[model samples]
Target chain A: MKLSRALGASVFAAILMTGGCDTVWHPSIPPVAGPAEFPTGQIARGAELAAIGDCSVCHTTEGSRPYASGRGVQTPFGVVYATNITPDPETGIGTWPESAFRRAMREGVDRDGRNLYPVFPYPHFTRATDRDIAALYAFLMTRPAVHADTPPNRLPFPLNQRFVLTGWDHLYLRPGAWQPDPAHDADWNRGAYLVEAVGHCGGCHTPRNVLGAETDGQALAGGEAENWYAPPLQAASPARQGWSVDSLTAYLRTGFDAGHGAAAGPMTAVTAELATVPAADVRAMAVYLTSMMPKPAPAPVVAHAGEDPVFAGACGGCHGPDAPMMRNGAPSLAMSTAVNAPTPRGTIQAILQGLPWREGQAAPYMPPFASVLTDAQIAELAAYLRSAYSDKPAWRDLPAEVARVRGAS
Target chain B: MIRLTVNGQQHEVDAEADTPLLYVLRDDLGLNGAKFGCGLGQCGACTVLVDGQPVFSCLTPVSVLAERQVRTIEGLGGNAVQRAFEDVQAAQCGYCIAGMVMRATALLEHNPHPHEDEIRAYMSGNLCRCGTHMRILEAVRQAAGQGVKP
Candidate 1:
């Protein structure tokens, strides 16, 4: 009877220990269906869908095997190395189930139930539909295995702790796929999906607060990145790079507006990867960007100088009473685009750098006297020009302004 | 060892043959015009003329250039195209100018007067983040003359 009682006690102890164990061993991830069964056509479609996500930019390291993932992405909080997404069983997503992949892409949760930081662009990607997401998964699984291992991130104390991300997501994230609006056209809807889901343009161009949360109120407006301004994408963009649909589309495909501006900084990477994408998608992006332009405001007119002493003495030589003498092809302050720009930054820049003359044109030229001019003098000249020919305000700070233009040059 | 002819001069160098021609040009030959905007072959800042074709020097391995003639921005002709660039003031910050000129030179050599669409298609790889593209297009068009239509 004592032996029987001891046996019962042992059985009960084993059951209790097993039930309360913290280290539950999960089964190995099951293999996804082979690519052959999915049809090669789907894979090609997947490739186009993957391009929308720009998967290669962050996932692959320069000069390394593609998709191996050792690229370091630096955020304000810390640096995170992208993980190997290739199918290597030892060091990559080789064993990730399709469901887990869908959950991670749509909900920003890893297979281990860890909340992924928004730096991975899951905020925008959350809008991706399951069909497209599944296609992407199928595409990724078929890629060859790359046996590279990126080092773990080195985020600061509380932020470094992955558990804290759970609360962060709860406060900031809204988990769901994109919902098309009944009011918008098919083209606009497609554009929105491409922009908000696949393109993830806001991940960089949009302004963010100290916590790296995007300020939605200022959507597509200008922001700063790595000390350079990501000029607003809205219709009111001061740079005037996307004035037309053609210009916008051409800029997206070629990485330059051909007449207005070109891509720089992080945008350089975007354009490079974008070059490989289909022309149709690029055109769609251009249509989307162009449609976002607000109504054009009438060009602000500069007030008459009315015999201002500085212009009378120093400027009259070229900008005379009538028919402003074109020096160095110096654009007539009366009708020049540089004089009429919304912001005086470019205008001030032109003055400081001195306008370069057209080589074969008969226009007069002005040498850049930036070296000789004091900060106040440059500011005064800028103020004088803006007040006389344009309605723009003088730059708030002159030295700082000159310094910025000088730095860019 | 790789045998490459740069700007008509032949040199033999011993190194990892897979090293990008951009590095070989910048580090080995001290040709600094090919800026390193992105190490991947995406950005055309490292574009160079390889056998009269514009190739991304960053993606083209040094070994791939064995006995190949390479032309950089420094070697591009000082013709109407260069004069047009000066006329339109097409460069800002000038970081991408070398690459831009090289690409344009290649375009002009193949099609002396390319239309707007052709210009856009051929020069899409080069990136100018400064937004000076309008001036660039105008300069190219002006160089090729205004009569050419896309």
Candidate 2:
């Protein structure tokens, strides 16, 4: 969810806007952190699991030898360097036994039994089954080992104390494999396992409580990731048009759906990686997700007296009647997902920076209007789209909202 | 197995209960007029008349249509709206026309001669990415003027 929002080079805007937060998770190279322990017996599945776990992303700093930890992860409290997970006898986890690696992953402790920082995402890793962890271990250990020293961390006083994560973990971590519901079909169960546990998609999607535990009852309801608002995944989301299994599957697999447009932000990276996961697995995720979508409410139509010349002069040149096609044809804004989205953020971001190429695919293009149109003008145009095409209520105080969003990102 | 009545013909077909009626119509029954533009309901491309009202067939599950009458462009027949659409050459690519025809038929069935404003608001849900809005409006007006019930 937030992945789509963090799309484009504009994520730097998120960093500029935040005042020290968990924004480290966004706009990073490498994929989500890759796994450490592997099921060496199932090396093939282990490699797949590592990609899904994003083990390589967090653990390996960009341009650095793979898994040679030294990549600085910026957290609200301080910076944490990822640990080396390669097979180097001296530097990496080469000498550690599977049991020690398992303890470190499941218990958030290191070889010498030191507490590891929560930034390692151990809370989510605890859900990985023993076998899968072993595969990941196998995958990591077999890598052409790189000899690089693990960088020292620079954390604020108490945050520097690694044991602080213990209390934090006690409050937030629930270590166990996600058990399945007997009632759901096999595909649904598969999807639940992948989404809630293996993929740990909810780690970034679900909102965290003060103790940093994902809040209950708000699952997939959206969160602020790396400064982007991952829109709610629940069926009741403001995405009034709704998501079908096919659309969701396509979006998850390819990152582009005519209704939703291209994936923006870090989601581009995810969908790129997701392309490698089994197609059946992605389809199952869609099946489970479409079941969760809510029916849309009856939205009244907005009657207008005359055509807003603003649209005619600008959007109309391409999107208006007789307008030439632009950007695989400017998606007819009338039925467009961005326009109909419950929150104005997607629409706002699209206008700020036109959709960019994703996964080697070039979509229709519209030059960014950030420098061209004033914030007030954008708000009016957006409001006009809601009233003109869709039956949803007009966005409130759209001018200030646009300025606030634009200024922040 | 699900039973459905399409174009006044009753038939039983094998499908998952939640499979979209559009798929049932196109893939099973071989009704090909409706196109799948956006499987989501936002776009009315896969629209068909369900009990005299235009419903997005892509989003309407076969289970929900078990007892309802379904009408695709193939079932809509050659009505005044279809005639006007042909007379004015309203369609360019024709991918979206099947849904457009279905929706216009429903609009005229509910109101034989709706005002231009009503036509614009009602048909807004039907997207014509080919820039055929003016011709579409003209066709609707021509249909309304003919005083033919859809």
DockQ of each: 0.02, 0.01
Q: What is the TM-score of chain B in candidate 2?
A: 0.97
Q: Candidate 1: global Cα-lDDT? A: 0.66
**TM-score of each model, in listed order:** 0.53, 0.57
Q: Encode model 1's per-residue lDDT on A1-409: one tens digit a residue.
A: 3443443344345435444323222223354443323566666767777777778888987556878898878776667888888877678777678777776777677666666777888878788887787788778877888899888886766566555555445445677778887787776677778887878887766788646767857767766554444656765565422256666666666555433544544555566566667877777776667677754344344458665443443345455545233433333464443454544565555555444332333322343434323456567767777677755565577667767766655
- The iRMS of the candidates, in order, is 24.1, 17.7
What DockQ class does candidate 1 belong to? incorrect
Candidate 1 residue A180 C-alpha distance from true site, Å: 1.5
How accurate locally is residue A302 in candidate 2, as Cα lDDT from 0 to 100?
A: 34
Q: Mind giving the per-residue lDDT tens digits that candidate 2 earns over A1-409?
A: 2332222123234334542335232221221233354444587777777767767667876568877878787654456889888888778877767776777778777666677776777777787789877877777777878888888898655456554455555556687776888999999988777777667676666777643457877888776444445666776555545677787788887776756555665466567667777788888887776778775334334354356644554455456545555454334566465566666776777766554433235433343445335677678778887788667777777887798778766
lDDT of each: 0.66, 0.70
For DockQ, the strongest prediction is: 1
